[model samples]
Target: MIKKPVKIQLSEGLDARPIALLVQEASQYSSSVYIEVDQKQVNAKSIMGMMSLTLLPGEEITVVANGTDEKEAAAGIERFLVNVKNR
Candidate 1:
């Protein structure tokens, strides 16, 4: 599996509630999503998993996408992490 590591800086991001919401929406992707957090394989597709990661601004995260829709999954997450701001 080819994994892409992206370093993102965090903003207020429309309050903390939105982060949970963002993870919820991202988890809907068909492809698998896992976060390389705390040197652990945390499932990004799960709200609990994402929340457990404690992702914040200026934090580097490695998102691993496997399966046929790998590109799509990676792109979706990439966009999310990049465009995240306090909106």
Candidate 2:
């Protein structure tokens, strides 16, 4: 298992479009991926689960991955959350 912390960078926050894009990116990995906010965690691949979290801009979150491709999955999510903005 691998875990990394990241903050949502979008000024507009994680709206519907960004969540969908993040979900799409997460679904590509074979590892089990989850996003954690406060003490709550949800499957990154589940759109409904992600939306339920109501993540906002500048909020700190954790990306966790565990599986054969855990490292890749964690890093990918970190990269997406850290670097990608508004898409």
Candidate 3:
């Protein structure tokens, strides 16, 4: 398992579209991926779960992944959150 804290750099925050895209990004990995904030954790691949987070720009979140592709999953999520323009 790997856990890494990342700051959201998205200018528009995690609105519906971004959340959907994020869910899609997470779904590509074989690892189990989750996003944690304020002691709340949700499956990164679930659009409803991610929407419940209500994450905003500048809010720090923890990306957790546990599986054969854990490292790649975590790094991909971190990159997605940090580099908004590419997403």
Candidate 4:
């Protein structure tokens, strides 16, 4: 398992589109990926699960992945969360 902290840089936090995009990005990995915040963790591949968090811009989150591809998965998610621009 690998855990890395990432701060959401989206100006408006993660809305429907962003969540969908994130979910899509996460689904590509074989690893089990999750985002943790405020003691709550949600499956990274589920849109509904991510929505439940109500994460806000600048909120720090932990990206956790456990599986054969854990490191790649975590790094990919961290890059997406921190560097991707809103479209």
Candidate 5:
């Protein structure tokens, strides 16, 4: 398992479109990916779960992945969350 803290850099924060894209990004990995904030954790691949997070710009979140591709999954999620261009 790997866990990395990432600060959301998206100017619009995580709305419907971004959350959908994020779910798509997470679905590409074979590992299980989750995002944690304020002691709440949700599957990164689930649009509904991610939407429940109500993530906002500047909010720090932990990307967690556990599986054969755990490292790659965690890094990918972190990159997506931290890069404004990805939003």
Candidate 6:
């Protein structure tokens, strides 16, 4: 298993539903991907779990990945976040 800490800067404050969908899609590529906010952790694969995160703008969320293709997972998510920025 491999673990990587990735930080993402939100382009704007986001609603729970859309953010959850993004995380869910990310996890589909790799189950090891996870999102952590306010000391609470959730599996990126679970939309419900990700919705529960409720992150705010400018928050540096930490993504932790542990499993096969962890590096790929992290890289994928990092690129996704940057590309989706509305700002």
C-alpha RMSD by candidate, in order: 2.5, 1.1, 1.0, 1.0, 1.2, 2.7
For residues 4-76, write the lDDT of model 3, one tens digit per residue: 9999997778888878888988999999999999989999999999999888878899999999999999998
TM-score of each: 0.78, 0.92, 0.94, 0.94, 0.93, 0.73
How many collisions between residues are there in candidate 3? 0
Local distance difference test scores for all models: 0.69, 0.87, 0.90, 0.91, 0.87, 0.66
For candidate 1, give the lDDT of residue 56.
Answer: 64
Clash-forming residue pairs, model 5: none
Backbone collision tally, model 2: 0
Question: In model 6, what are the clashing residue pairs, if there are any?
Answer: none
Off by over 4 Å in 5: 84-87
Candidate 3 global CA lDDT score: 0.90
Of 3 and 5, the candidate ranking higher by lDDT: 3
**Candidate 3 colliding pairs:** none
User: What does candidate 4's lDDT look like per residue over 1-87, in tens digits?
Assistant: 999999999887888888888999999999999999988999999999998888788999999999999999999999889876744
Winner by TM-score between candidate 6 and candidate 4: 4
Which runs in model 6 stand beyond 4 Å of their true positions?
1-8
**Descending-TM-score candidate ranking:** 4, 3, 5, 2, 1, 6
* lDDT, model 4, position 71: 96
- Candidate 1 clashing pairs? 9-58, 10-57, 13-86, 14-86
Better of 5 and 6 by TM-score: 5
